[model samples]
Target: MLELDEKFFSRFGAEYSPNEIIFCEYEPGYEFYFIQKGRVRIVKIINDMEKTIDVLGPGDVFGEMAILEEQPRSATAIAMDSVRVLKFHRDNFDALLQGNPQLAYKLLLIFSKRIYDAKRRLMILLLEEPNVKVMDVLIMLAEQNQQFDFESEITLNTTVRQVASWAGMAESEAQKELTHLARLDKIELYEDRIVVKNIRDFQRIVASRRKNLYSS
Candidate 1:
């Protein structure tokens, strides 16, 4: 979580529930938020279809880009579950950052990482095969939401539609590829989740896909 002065939160703390819209794409952004709990999905409407670009959990921040750039929002922020957030008006945010150098540095690091991840996803989308694209997205999600357990499996707390959206493919196509991978014993798919049996093997598959992309 961001280390803000108590005065900041006393004025800005707010709560939201699942399916709530925090902000809409292209709308003017007045405030930015830091998640205190739960998750939020960053989505964009492409060709009239909503595509989820990223999921954020506790300690994550959103809406700052628009504030910093002084432009309309680039994407829509929707609550994924019960969420608590600290909202800061543009002036308050600037003041907070000025007072807390460490927080500002942390925000810079987060933005840098997001940019790098976006570039990587773009590269993955350029791959030719839908199967490869699906596998790449699965691996990426697994890495982002890694689960440490005695069983050595990584579980994705996401749905097929979101995965398909990330892969730039239809749900049916993503489901088919996922089922094929499951049949090959590469992963275990449940009604609401997916489990990668071995993280090492998952990485190997992703690496092979990259190799094939280059080799071809």
Candidate 2:
């Protein structure tokens, strides 16, 4: 890793709320990477629809692709949770390329990983059935935690607009689904977080919509 000045990160550019977009107008800027905590979803507006390009969690990085290419940002990045990210200006990249070959190589690796994950997400999005896709999202979250406390609730800080972008659905459809699920006692809204109430019930929904990938 290249030497980074911690003091330089005092402000961290800008802060964001869950589902709050960081770059809406898509102007020229520096590349940024979240070194602290939380999740971020990179999105793009296409055909008047907000489409999620990728989901980035802690230790994950983004925004360098545009800076490297000397192009405008291809998409918007929204905070999936309250987040702090370190930004690297174009000058910083220029310096690294000129003075630190190792750092330059590291940036390449990060870009590769981002591309790989984006491909996987695109394939998953192609699957038919909204129910199945939604179930997959829940299962993915469950696996992220790797816990099975039926009594405990797992809350996600996301909105219908954000979930719709992630699931390739209309915002209204996503809202309807969420409302239906909540009415059926499958989930509950606890403040800003969406809580999965009955874990077993949610699992059954996932199992019912399970595809071949769920098999051993």
Candidate 3:
């Protein structure tokens, strides 16, 4: 999906099954990858629970930060589906980029967007309300995945416990807000997923709470 040159397909392409571990956190960073198909989940252990911080689709890049900093991986990458990716090793990465100007520009654009996204997530963490944090985390994921819509139902492949971990709150607190949202028909909770009745429904509540954060 990245419009990568066919020259690398045969030489560097790799395939993975669903639930396969691409790399683990703190491991040596030998290479980075760009998704060619399906999805990859970027996870980290937060409050002793594994949480999906980012879900990457085709054309996305992961494991680059480690390569850049010459350090261990910051998070774990897992295949969420039968996925295909093009792997780039650190040794040859410079040569490849020097020869492929177009590829370098494309990757620069993506890295810029990732930085902006990180800033927005930091703002979400600044909010004091546990409930708003939960809703904002959902909003953040939906927005990142480009799946948010006011009139359409979207099922987030996440559970209350995962949400709590991402939001840095207790699981019980996240579940309570989820149940309240379900009572209002804003969301439908399942064992492993939460179907957002309308993405904008949660958006409105999150915005309103932020507005009243300094109010009496």
Count residue pairs with overlapping backbones in model 2. 0
1-216 per-residue lDDT for model 2 (tens digits):
334466645744456677777765367756656445678887778888667767877656677765657667777888889976766666666764676576577778887866765664564476566755554555445544646465576776656665666677777886777777788777774445577766666666555545444552
Pull out the clashing pairs in model 2: none
For each candidate in the order shown, give its overall lDDT on alpha carbons.
0.82, 0.65, 0.83
**Model 3 per-residue lDDT tens digits across residues 12-64:** 89999999999999998989898999999999986687878789998888887
lDDT of 1 by residue, 1-216 (tens): 676666766678888899999999999888888898899999999889888888899999899785567889999999999988988788777787777787788789888988978886897698788887887887777667535542587787778887788788888999999899899897888889988777676567678878887888
Q: Please rank every candidate by lDDT, starting with the best.
A: 3, 1, 2
- Model 3, residue 185: C-alpha shift (Å): 6.3
Please give the clash total of every predicted structure, in order: 0, 0, 0
- Residue-level lDDT for 161 in candidate 3: 79
lDDT-best of 1 and 3: 3
Error of 1 at 177 (Å): 0.8
Q: Report the error of model 3 at residue 110, Å.
A: 2.3
- The order of the candidates by TM-score, greatest first, is 1, 3, 2
Residue 117, candidate 2: alpha-carbon lDDT: 56
- Tell me each candidate's RMSD, in Å, in order: 3.7, 6.8, 4.2
Q: Name the candidate that leads on lDDT.
A: 3
Candidate 3 lands at a TM-score of 0.69
